[model samples]
Structure formats: structure tokens, C-alpha cells
Target chain A: MANVTAVTREPSSEQELPHPYLLFLGDTVHPGFAKTAFGLKQWAPELCLGQFALPSAQIDLGLPNLRPAEARAKGARALVIGVANSGGFIAASWIPALVEALQDGLDIISGMHARLGDIAELRYTAERHGRQLIDIRTPPPRIPIATGLKRSGKRLLTVGTDCALGKKYAALSIARAFAERGVDADFRATGQTGIMIAGSGIPMDAVVSDFAAGAAELLSPDAAPDHWDVVEGQGSILHPAYAGVSLALLHGSQPDVFVVCHDPGRTHLLGDEQFALPPVEEIIDLTVRLGSRTNPAIRCGGIALNTSKLEAQEAEALCAAESRRLGLPVADPIRGGPAFDALIENCLAAPASS
Target chain B: MANVTAVTREPSSEQELPHPYLLFLGDTVHPGFAKTAFGLKQWAPELCLGQFALPSAQIDLGLPNLRPAEARAKGARALVIGVANSGGFIAASWIPALVEALQDGLDIISGMHARLGDIAELRYTAERHGRQLIDIRTPPPRIPIATGLKRSGKRLLTVGTDCALGKKYAALSIARAFAERGVDADFRATGQTGIMIAGSGIPMDAVVSDFAAGAAELLSPDAAPDHWDVVEGQGSILHPAYAGVSLALLHGSQPDVFVVCHDPGRTHLLGDEQFALPPVEEIIDLTVRLGSRTNPAIRCGGIALNTSKLEAQEAEALCAAESRRLGLPVADPIRGGPAFDALIENCLAAPASS
Candidate 1:
């Protein structure tokens, strides 16, 4: 609300503001404007700042030791943090309790404000955008769910065996698909990556930061109803200690649909069967474990034939067949190019029969 | 101490044992067992029937949530929770805090315990092993550290321009170097991946759950002093979140040195000539911002050549020269084959100075 300026860096007004609110949901850290600005400006000028949304976050280093009262004095807001690769996040264990407490109507804070309960009206906002659950809330010391409650757009989740399996690409493609479907989906990384808004149709040129400043404005209620979409990327598997931390951020605000991205070549392990990644079955199992079973989680569709591994016709046939088997529609989002765009539109147009 | 009996299918003998004591020390996740077993094994592993140590951990489903009373009721033993990727890990943050509180000053959950005014006793130990760290402490529900103590262990921040440029690989290699120097350096996903340790090491076959069990024993002080060195395989940097988190686990344990892994290929693109990774640099900046500047950090080494990218001879020469320049006792930790074994051994060796 305070002009949405960088807490540390000097704000650049003339240079289209980094779509601090455009969540770039993916596993791999997408390049930030500073990095993407290197070349390809002519064709993808939007990738520079105004036309794209980067996943990079700018962390507020000064807030680590601030008490809730002090943080409040400093205008600190409540947050809903998500870790993409839970098994691999540095502060992984702290997430669940933080999310749980917030879900149970407790105001979670750091060492300084551990006891400053109730002063901050914080909640983890979960919105169903497109077909996935998008966790667009900021990290603690600033949960932005209440303000942006009205703008809950699309929700997307990308799952892979690990970061190497190309979940990030799938997330971006899904975000693109949602945009083409006339839905506003913001890419959100739940783990270590910075924001990335490549391909097309984004808020700014891939704004990247260590914090969730990208979707900061949209996270509040005062923001316009731009019909947003969120692409939430996860770093790695969520382990037990603080098991449901990430999902808790989505507790009060669950997504509409949950799409699991699988690089068929990798997930199916070339159909070796035994090598299925993230063990598709296990992911579905874990969602229930984290208590998200109540939400309608359909396979929706998947990305199996990566251009790097399959032929065009083969890719088409693979997606089409998978959709047929699942009694749903699927597309390449990226490889199918514009035609793929049509497929996504059709899927979104279909009834929410599930 | 209790016997660490091996069981079939589910092993809970040690986990269920009363007065369970698990001793953890340093960041053993990298060049250690956790990284090796991760992604390969299910989150559940009956850590010693009653008390056991995990090489590394992240918030997960299998992690048992023990309240303060539950932890204290277990009694007379300690569990050394080592720093995983950075800042060291908290089994379940509050769980450890609760454990520390319940122990009534006779336990060491993590560096937090140290801050909480608990006595710093035997460094490490494991069940069945006659190590003193496991024998002399009471149980948990304690706040290892006081309400406001800064955590222990090294915190690694990554600095790099983009992925594929070798930042993640560089980070892993550096973590290994620090471990060799006896500095418990923990890693957290920072910027776009640069160099990673994804596809290297003993391969996935060596990652059976049984092996992890053995590893936990070996890392315990009760085991042979040289146990960790004899173990095979090392951690990988497959995902950014996991990589960073694991790195942080290592860092929090406070190793003797901080090594920055860089890729000569993108030395210039990395912004900081010193570390060669933007995230690494950002980490350094963040650390400084967090107000800890006395720690010694270094740009120890990196991967020199990829066959398609550079001549083999040049890559080898550059790697050798860099190792030589640093007076490093080992060669390229990332590229060398079995020779990497020596790298692992060297990484585990305590630093002479520290």
C-alpha cells in the first residue's frame, strides 16, 4: 500500500514497475529482469519488465529480529509462506506450525513477536484459479490474504520427482494456458526459485526477488479485480516434521483444481512403470495426508511429451490419448503453440463436472 | 543406551524405546547420508527405535510431532539434530523448542539449546554406542535456545545469474569443501541454479533405507570415530529448495571453512568475481546484512569443463590449477570419478585449525 516500493533497493518509477504481484509458480528459479534483460529485448520486450511477471523476490533482511509490535510499528503485515521443495527448504520445519497456527486463527510471528497474538488479522488465502490451488500469500511477518481475498484467481501446482524433472516449465506453460483461457493466473513459486514470466502476456518483465513482492499489491483487497491466475512452484517433496506447512497456507483458501505436471519421459521413467516419479500415486496420497483430500483433485491433464524427448505427432498422440484415457482434454501448452492454447481454452470451457 | 536392533519392514524398536537419545553433529547431509537417501527413500524411516539421528531432514509427513510433555516423558537422553542445509534444522522447530524446555537444561536439541542456557555436553553419540553425548542428557520439550537467541551454524546464501550456469553444482562442491574443512555449512536455495550435484555420487542404488539406518549409526559418536569417512556416497543438488535447505543444515553445524563453488564457464556472468554465483554473493550480502561479518568465506573451487563446452585438457588443467592455488588437498570434487571418494573423505575430516 505504501507505493509498493522495494524495502532496500531504490525504486525505479520510469522502468515499468516489476509486476511484484505476478507470482511465477515453478520449481527452478526463473531469471529476473536484471538477468533476462541481457538479450532478446526486441521480440520479448515484455520479458524486460512491463509485459511479464518474474518470480524473483526481494527479502526484507531487516525484519528477522523485529518483534511483532516492532514489526507492526514498522508496518509489517502478516504473511502466508509456501515452500516449493519442502524436503529441501532450509527453514522447512517452521512452515507447518506457522501455517497451522494461522489456520487455527493464530497470528504467527518471529522471535520478536512470538506472543503478539491477534493484533494482526492474518490468514492464508487459497483461491481456485483455473484448476489448481494458488498460494499467493507472502511469508510471515506479512501474510497478505485478507486484502487479496477478492482476487483469488487461478491455482496451479507443478509436480515432478525432483527439480530436474522440468516442473518449472510446466508451471509456466500452465500459467500461459490459464491466461489464454481468459483467466488471470499469477505464477507463484512455493520454493527457492525467483519469479519468471516468459512466453507472453504477463504484468512486467520477469520481476525477480527473494520475497513475494511480485504479487504484493494483488494480495490485498484494494487491488482491482483483474481476474488473476497463480502458478505456484514447489522446490521439492514436503517431508513430515512440519508436514502441512505449505498446504496450510492454502487452508482457508483452497484452490479450485489441482493439476499435477508429469514429464512422461521422466515420470513414467520411459514407461518402465516401476520408476514413476513423485510416484504420482504418492502425490495424491500426500495431498490427503496433508488433509487436502476434501478439495477436488483431478489429474486434470499432464505434460508428458516434452519437445526435448518426443516427436511432434508423437507428442500430440500422447497427450490426446492420455486425455482420452482420463476422460479429459489435455494439450502441450508450449509445443502445440497456438493450437495448444485452444486446447486449454476448451478445458476451461468444459464444465466442472468433478 | 539401547540396542539398535534391525527390523524388517517397519523398524520402530529404537523409535519406541523410552529415554531415546539421538546425537547429531555438524552438517552431515552433504557428502553424507541424507542427501544420498533423499528422493530415493520414503520420508518414513524409524530413526533409532526410541532415539535416532537423521543425516538431514526437511518438514515431512512421517516426522512424528512430539509435544513438550511427550518429549520430556521419554527422558534421560539427547538427540543431536545437525544442521541440514543451513542455520541447522529444528526437528519440528517448536517440537525441538518444546523438547529443549522439557529437558530442564539437561538437553541439547540444537544450537538453540546452547542459546537456551543448556549445558553443552558430549558432542555426539548414537544408541548402542557408548558415546557420552547420548548417555548424560535428559529428554525434550525444551527451547534449545532462549526466546531470542540467534541460531548457530553457517548460513550459505547463493549468488549467481542463472541456472545451467553451474551455481547449484558450485554450491554443492563448496559445501563438500567446507565439510572437509570441518565447517558445518548449511545451504538454502538462493538464486537461479548455477552448479548442482544432481547426477553425481554413488548413484541411487546405494540409497536404500537400510543404508540410511547404517549411516545414522555411523554418524553417531558411539560408532567408530572413522565411521563417517568409511561411508560411501554423498548428497546431491537435485532441487533448489532441497539443495538450499540441505546446505543450510550443513552450514548451521558450523564447519571450519566456507567454500563457494563456481563454474569457470560463467565466471564473468556471475556478477561477483569472488564467488562466481549470484545467490552465493546474495547470501554473503544477506549474512552481512544479518550482521555476522567475522566469518571467513572463500571461493574455494568449481567444475572446469564439460566435454562439449571446453577441451578436456583445458578443463582438467584449470581444475588442477585451482585446487593447487587454494592448497586444496583434493582435485575437482564434481568431475573426478572415484577420486571424488577422497573428496568426501577430506570433506569429513575435521579442520586442523578449527
Candidate 2:
């Protein structure tokens, strides 16, 4: 899918945040974070998914089955999001959240209905770099990547492997790391399909999707203030039907600082046992090749490793080594935490041209 | 996606070699070979799209776009057939030719329109196989699979798979191979939905399918005949969907030979610097496990490997190694030709129950 809008969302401390922020919430918040992170690892490696234990003080912030605008207006910092006709619980609450999130700078993200019962009452949570959630009562609207890049703000993008993996988790982890380090960033899920680029300061908002038939309403150009378009792909790129949607997104709307969340584990080599994660050098080469192939002048930022299985030290070391190998700052800040935050911070740091 | 009746005509001794036959007789010729092969392959690699090569033939068999019965009557020794609401070529042909082909023994297979262009027909043009082309025309009728299997020379049930690397190709390939090797086999497609099995050898006159919606026309308690069924892995056996489908099929239809075609590429784990292929031992274990998981006493036969890039030799070696490791002769004779022929042969070769 294509990036929707290409406006600048520089991390100006004075810029107005979304009033009554629209957080596309789902059931099983942290687990959703975990799953999102796992999925994002396949796209961005240096980014991390941080799992901050919810503080005992937070209440169950659920706009159960509320419209996006309704949820936003009713003092919901997070709106549990779902698909339009998905015959599921989260679908009822989250579908509208997405619309409102886009319309009013709502800090909305997609959520699932399956695990709603687990942590129904969400409370205060913590990120690795000490950006603890005192209360989600006033979650700030994340600065769009375009704006950050205009002011040379670090920008990052976190992409999930497929449907389920902790994309939000990884984005949060990456975002919080940079935030604590005094970098401005935002974390968001572009949509529910594939290769969702968040924290790319660029306000280019569009989703070029192959499965647009399933999520067409969300991709309307008029849905959000950002530019939105749908596109297709050639062959199986990352996963089956992934390349088409990503190609559409990249070509349809050019977002500055594309931080791809990647998991080497998901990459299959024509079913050959001899083909696993190509060497780090090969990965860099492949990344450049992929970027070039996608667009000759396309500039790619650092890789974000999904440290789903790795501990903090191991993941950090792995990211650092990869960064050195690729001559890029591989910041996998959160080991065993949500990688989404780390992803946001990474996007904030990306050089605009590259 | 259901199999159409096929016209089985032996080449006359006086006929010249390299006989021109309809590679695909539109939607009427049995798609037996195409369906099973394609279905098996589809079930193999988790890759969504299926690729098939059209059968090799000097000229079209004049069976494109023919309706179900009309296409079956085409005077080809071995015809690839399928089902289409609007049949194409046979609007003017005599019914007698079709009946004669079916009665005298027509080598038929089933398939669908989507992959019709892919199944490469390898016609045995040489008379050395004691083949002949006859001009004896007859009326169109639903011919039985073979003589001895039926006490009254009729069939009760038939099974097939979905489009592209599924059970249709597997079933037809086996059927063709068996017939070539002196075993009587009748093939049928199960429409766009379920498996279609034709019971011809043992007893009964009509074909039977497990399809509950409209199977009463053929299914009868007294109907007795040689039976075969095709089942594709719906979901990963580990996946809940697969478990459910497997259980339902096994319990409902106690199939004779459970032919499974799968790709060994997708199941392997991904690691750094090198790729991994799931061990053949694991496949054996999984197949046996799946069989036991589905039903207690169901005899799980051999596993067929569907290779995309691997050459025939490599594929055979892989299958042989797996078979040896599993302590069973994994039938690898299909060798990249087609799926139906291999499947049909597999069914015919399955040892009779004690």
C-alpha cells in the first residue's frame, strides 16, 4: 500500500497534539504489542518491541464498540480498533477509531478482539528509556515523520511480517528509546494490511494494498487529511501478496525516512535449505538492492531487528554489530520489550535524503 | 473445479505415431490429473499462488470451451477434462463417439479452466505400447472406471482437489499411470468446491461425493464400487483450521489411499547465514501424526514432494531419502510431469485392505 500523505510533521514542541487523542485500541493491549513487534521484526531489525508492565493504577481504557469519532470525543486516549465487517469484537470498536485517528491527529492504533479478556483494564506502562506512562489520560499525538525530517528530527518506520506480530510494541519500544534520549517521535499503524510505516515524520499517509478490497474504506483519499492511494505488486516480495501492497504504497506516496522492520527468520529462499539469513553484508547489499529496485533514488535508513526471542543485551549487541556492518546506527533499544517505540525513534533519526 | 467425464480411446494399430489429441477438452474432459497434482503442490508450499505449465501438444485437441458431456466425447485416447457452465467446442459432435470412447475404455482425467493452459500433455504417440486410434462412434454416457472393480460395471464415488497443485492433478496422474500400467481408473473433478470420487470397479452405477449439499443424487447406501478420496491440508495441521478439516474428512469418508502432496520448503526454519529445510524425518513423523490425529486406524501412505526449482533427479533423491528414512517407499514416480496421474496411480497401487 502507498503512504497516504507527504506533509511535514516536524517535532515542534509547540505544535498542537490531537485533542482527545484517538488511539486505535484493541483487546489484549500488551500481547498485541508483543505480536506487533514480532511481525515488525521481519521488516525493521534495529527497532525493538518493548513490553512495559502496566502500572497498577491505570484503569481499563476501553471505548468498547464506539465509533472512531465517538470514542475520541468520549475521553478515550486509546480506541480499540478493528476491521469494518470482520464479524469480530475489536472490529466494532476499532474501525471508527482509525477514521477519527486520521481525521483529528488521534493517537489511534489497531487492536484485536481475541485477547480483550486478558488485560481489559489498561493502566500506566513503562518504556525502556524511562518514558513511563503516568496515565494514558493524555497521550500525545505522535509527530509525523515528514515534519520531524524537515527539522532534522529522527524518523523511523516499523513494518510487521504479516498479520500478527507486535508491530505496535516494536514501534513503542523504538519511539520511547529516542524520546528518553530527547528525540521526538511518533508510533502508529498505517493500516491493518502489510508494511505499515510509522514515525516517518513525513505526513504522507496512503496505503497501497493488494487486499484493498478487504480494507478499501480505510484507504480512501478523503478518509484522512493525508494523501492516500492504493497500488499493487509483481511477485511475492516479503510474504505472499506483500510486495504488491508495499510497492503500491512506496510508489503511490513517497514518505521520507522509510525504516523497514524486518525478521530474517521469515525470509524464505526459494525453499532451498542453503538460503537462510544472508550474511550481514548480503543483507545490506540486499537492502540497497531492494531500495534501488523499488526506486532508484530511494534512500533507506537503518535496519530494525525484532528481538522477540533475544534478551536485552543480546538484542542490543546484535543491533550494534549490524549497524557497524552496514555503516548505519542500528539502534535496537528495547530487548524483550516492544520494538515499535524503538522504530519511531529510529525514523526520527533518519537522514531525509537517504 | 469438478472433473468432467473423459473419452478413453486406444489408438488403432494402423494409426501413425504422435497422435494429435486434445490437450484439454474444454470444461468436459476429466481434470483428474490436473486437479490432484495442482492441489498437492498448493498444499505443499504455503505460497498462495499456484503455477502450472500447459501440457505439450502439437495442436489443440479441439476441446476448448466445450460443455461437460460434449467435451468428454472428443475422440482422443487420453483426454484432460473439466466442468464449465458454458461448454465450448462440442456443440455439433455426435453422441455415439463419446459413448464408444467411454464404453471401450477412455483414459480420462479432471481439471479446471484457470490452469487449463498449464497442464502439459505428454501423449504416448508410439504404437509400441500397443495403442490404436479407432473411428467407432457411440453415444455419450457416464462410463465406469473399469470392469472388474464393479460387480455390475459401475461406480459409486470419486474424489478430487482444488485448483492449482491440488488433488485433481494428483488423482488424474495416478489414474492415467495406473491405466497405462493395466489398472482400470476413472477420474472426475469435484466442481469448484469439494472432492469428487467415482466408484466404478466394485459395484453401483453412479459416482458419489462427500458433498452434503447435492450428493444425494449419487450417494446411496447400497451403492458399492471402488472408492478414492482426495484431501488437501486445509491449514497447517498445527493450525486449528487444518485440524478441523482433517477430522471432518477422515470421519466422513474412510478413504482407501490418503495421497498427500506437499512442498518441503516453507516449513523449514530460518537462521543466520544459511537456510534450513524441514527434515524428511519430520515429514514422516508429521504425516503419521496427522493420520493418527485424524483417525486411529487410517493407514497413512507415502508422502509426495512437490519441487518447484529442483530438477527431477534432485526431487527423486529427496523423496527417496525421505521414504527410506520413513521406512516406506515414498512414490516419486510423478517426477514433475503432472499431479493427477501420480495420484491416480497411488490410489490404484494402494494394497487392498485385509
Candidate 3:
């Protein structure tokens, strides 16, 4: 974290980067692994200049294919590692391409478990070329354990049924919707892509376990009485692997209201399909019961379903049915309309218990 | 964990250290901060040769007082850091004394959040002296995310109502009782002190939040059909700050049965007294419901009450009353008499629901 490591400093909050990026997809064949690129292209399309990937890569951003030099020529200031490679390591085969990008006059950025500064080739190349090697996942130094104190202002966190569903999208959409309604709100990111979009957040999963809750507390600090910090959530509490991160975020944020984000199409938990996803009703019940330790007035806002697979008519019918059954608003953020608007209104309704 | 840091490598399981120790109490006044020392003295007294503390320190182990050279002459090989400093950082005031220990030809062992090898003076001194600077809280590398696959054999985890109120002691005692009963059982350490005693464990708090449960899985892998891993627990499920760590351990261990460890006299949580402790009934209910995600047959073993503050007669009466009322064995581990034996026996009584 200091003199021994190549990178000398950790970002205090969200890390900033050069605009107009060339997204590096590496050799990712699975679309899930290339979420970073997809997220950035979706949320900050204007900043993403082009896309680059190995020939073996199967997924695409549909942006122009450009080498680092070509992107640099088109005013791209950085080459962002857009794909989350399996095992969180920079693949040995991908080194030459990363080195080439550095040599082509662009800064390099990554959000992997392994630090970019630890890679000798990339570290040396960046130092020689005077370009930055930024790691977005690094949490700030001296994050104290959470006090469990209820902070000022309103908070709406996006809880989920599983990982990589629609938590971040739901949070971003809710924050945007609040803004459009002339409500003071901010999108509080908690992952790599969201951090890139919002320019700040604590990577909840990357933090040491003991300080995970504390980091969440820091991510959305106490605000004004009427302001809302729309907190982007991480893994689901029902998830076997990452639930700890999810629980920590829950306890630390102590959100007054929460929305369940789910991929209605997914029958089972992501990664390990042996277990099925808990229903939205179960998520709301548990989030309230557990979150009450910090904020006794905790309530559920509604359900945010990622009905991306269904046809428009089918999706609307499904939402309507689910809404009727659960007695709560349900909508896909991307398919924003009356349903989505109702969700925004539902979020602000005080005494809104699930 | 590799070339970038002073320690060239990480252990795959619990870190091992030289035996026959001098416990370093630092300049601590609160006994709570020196739990490592207290736990070791209680569980592995034979390995503790003497106690070492600064003049300002008020807590004592009641063992022979010795300097590094004196303890070394008395057959101590490692100077164990007994105190967990308030901020988890080694104070500058304690440095000169630590240096004196390193100069006296013994390894310096610690379980602090900050790495001993990261401290320039200590790192250089250890390097010059060719002595190990052991950090017991270092977790295994390449800890995979938990799959939540239930493993072979029976497991009993010591869950708690709060931190440091006898979870480790209860696990150790239960495992010992199992051994005495001619049952095949292994004590799985989850914290620093337990690691030092058992010679292998994953420091649950030190793991990345994403892999906290994964690390717990590695700590007690698949075992024999008749074997029982008495997995030591960490934070409480009701804890605002550390419940994530607790939940991860719970899901990863996936204990068929669990015992609730609590301090009977405490009205509120340890560090933060703003919140009151949730009833043991609440812990059992939530644990069973949430734990059913990975382990549908999860059951409560009993209650382990740390009744150290009460008189002997009062403690026995209180435990007996609680046992009768709750229909679950309740006993103080330290006072291992009839009640303690019943608690241990009840742990094996299958279908032991709360």
C-alpha cells in the first residue's frame, strides 16, 4: 500500500479516470465476465471511445474495434480493463496486449483481485511511459469498523436475489428517477463498474471482511435531512459465497427503505446453480428483520425485476401479475414507463413497510 | 502476498509458530483487548512460559514475569503479541520494547491487522536476526468462493450472541468433551488465538468479504462419516458491524448443529452499547431460517453461557433454570460439571432443534 508497491496511493472515495476510454475485453468468452465493459457502455457511453479484445474473445461491445494507438488518435485517454477475467488475475497471455496499450500513450486501469502494480511488466511500462496504473477496487486506508449509528437523510438500497442481477442498474435508475422528480438524490456506487460511472465507491467485495460494513458506512455518509443516497448493493444475503459482503453492506448502510433486484428469468443462484434463488417476498422479510438491528424503521420499497428476456407485452403482463400477487410495484428499470414511475413513487412513500 | 511484500509467501491453512511463549500485553488497560493472551492461557497454558507487559499495562496473566532474554532462557522461543491494540496498529511507544525482543534472539509473533513485516524497523531487525515475524491472522491464498455444497460428516459450530464471550472456549471444550467420550472430533479454529492453539485455521476477519465463507469451508473440509468439526465461530449474527463475518462462517461451515455462546450478564453489545443484545431465541430462529439456504436440516445444539460474573451457586441455579425453561442444555464451559457434560452430550443428540 506504500513504498513497496508500485502504486503509491489509494483513492479516498471513488477513483477518477481519463475520459474517452478504449475498453479491453481480454480473452473473455463469457458475456458475464465482460460486464464492466457493458456497464460502462450503458451508463457512460460518451466516455467509451472504442473496444479492443483478443481474437478468441466471443463477446463484443459493438463499438468500433481499435488498437490503443487508434483509440488514442480518436481522443481516448485510457485503456480500461473492461473484462473481469476469471480468478481475478491478469492472464499471462494478456500481458503483451496491456504493455502495447501502455506504450501507445494511454493510462491503464484495472479492478481485479491482483493489483496491477504487482505485475512487473505493466508496472515498469507505466513508470517508464509516465502513465498511471489505477486499481479501482482498492479501499481507502483506515476504514474503521461500523458504529451502527443511524445516519441523517433518507437511504434506499438495492438488495438482490443473487449477484450481478440488476442491483446497480436499479440503484442508478432510482437515483435518476428521483432527480427527474426534483428530489435531491445521489447514486452511491459499491462495485467497480458503478464506481467508474459515479466517480466514487468502496468496492464492498474487495474489502477485508472485518471492515466490510465500515466501508459501506463510508460509501454513503450522513447527508441532509431530505436528500436520498441511492446505494448500489452487492451480493445477495441468500447467496452462499458473497452473502457476507451483502450483510455487511446492509448493516452499515442501515437503509430506511430497500428494493429487491432480481433476474426473474434466473431459476437458480448464479455461479452455483445447485441452489434456487429465494423469492422476492423472502428477501424483503429478511432484509427488514436483520436490518432492524441498525434501523428499526427499515422497510421495503418494492421489487425491481430485470425482465430483459421477455417480449414487451409479456414483460408488462408479468410485472402486472407479480405486482398483484406481491401487493407492491414491480418494473424493469430499462423498460421505464408507468410501472417504473410507480416504483419511484412507492420508494418515497413514508411508512412504506413491505 | 508474494514479491511485493516482506513475507515472501502465505500459508495455505493456519500459520504455525514456535512454542513456549512470552505473551506481550503491550500498554493495554482493558482485558478485552488482550483476548488472545487470555484465550491462550486458558486453552494452552503449557505453551505459555511467562507474561511480558509494559509498566502502563494493568491486565496480567498471573504467570511469571520475564524479559525476552529471561523468557528465552526459560525455553520460550516466540514472543506472542498478547494485546490487540485499540486501533490494531502497533504503537510507536511499544517499538523499542519489540526491538529489544528481536535483539534477544526470539521470533516475534502477532495477530494484529497491520503486518509486523510492514513495520520498517521490525522487518529490518527480523531480517538481520534471521528470526520469523509471524502473523497468525494471515489467511490462506487462493480461497475460492463458497459453493455451499454440504460436506460429509457431522459438524458443530459455536455461534454466539456477541464477540469474545466464550465462543472459542465453548468450541474447545465441546471438542475436548467429544474426545473424552471416544468420539471422533476436530476443533476448527476461526480466529487468531484458536489458530495458534490448533496450529491451523483461517483468520475469518482477515479474509476478503467475497471469500469469507470460502475460507471457512477450507478451514473444515470434508471429513470422515463419524467425524465432527467443532468449528469456532466469530461475530454474532445480531452484531451490527461484524454479522457478515458471522454469517459467512455459518453458511460455509454449514454445521448440522450449532451452540449459542453468550455472556449471561451483558445487557448490551461489547464495543457499542447503544444497542441491546437480542434474545438467544432470536439468534436460533434467524440462524435456522437463514442457514437453511445451504443446510435445510440445521439445528441448535444448546447454549454456552459464560457465567463468570456470577457466584458458583447462582451460576448453577441460573443455568439449570434456563435449561428447564428453554428445554436446551445451558452451561458455562469453564464450570464443566454436570450441566456442561449435558450440553456436550446434547450436541450429539441429533434433531436437536431450539
Each model's DockQ score: 0.01, 0.02, 0.83
The full ranking of all candidates by lDDT, starting with the best, is 3, 2, 1
TM-score of chain A considered alone, across all candidate predictions: 0.45, 0.42, 0.88
lDDT of 2 at A313: 74
Provide the global lDDT of candidate 2 against the true structure. Answer: 0.33
Ranking by DockQ: 3, 2, 1
lDDT of 2 by residue, A231-275 (tens): 111111232212223322332222334444545445533332332
TM-score of the second chain for every model? 0.29, 0.41, 0.87
Q: Could you tell me the lDDT of residue B152 within candidate 2? A: 21
> Highest DockQ among the candidates is held by which one?
3
Taken over the whole model, the C-alpha lDDT of each candidate is: 0.32, 0.33, 0.86
Ranking by TM-score: 3, 1, 2
Q: Which candidate is the best by lDDT?
A: 3
Tell me each candidate's TM-score. Answer: 0.32, 0.29, 0.89
So what's the TM-score on candidate 2?
A: 0.29
C-alpha lDDT (0 to 100) for residue A53 of candidate 2: 18
**Residue B165 displacement (Å), model 2:** 24
Q: Candidate 1 lDDT, tens digit per residue, B1-354? A: 433221111111233213232323232434343431232122113332132233343333233444334444655343434333443233343344433433432333332212222222222222223322211111211112111112233233233233344334434554555566565443322211100112111111111111221211212112233322111111212111122222222222222233333445554332323222333344333322212211233222222222235565776666566556645533344565533445444544555555
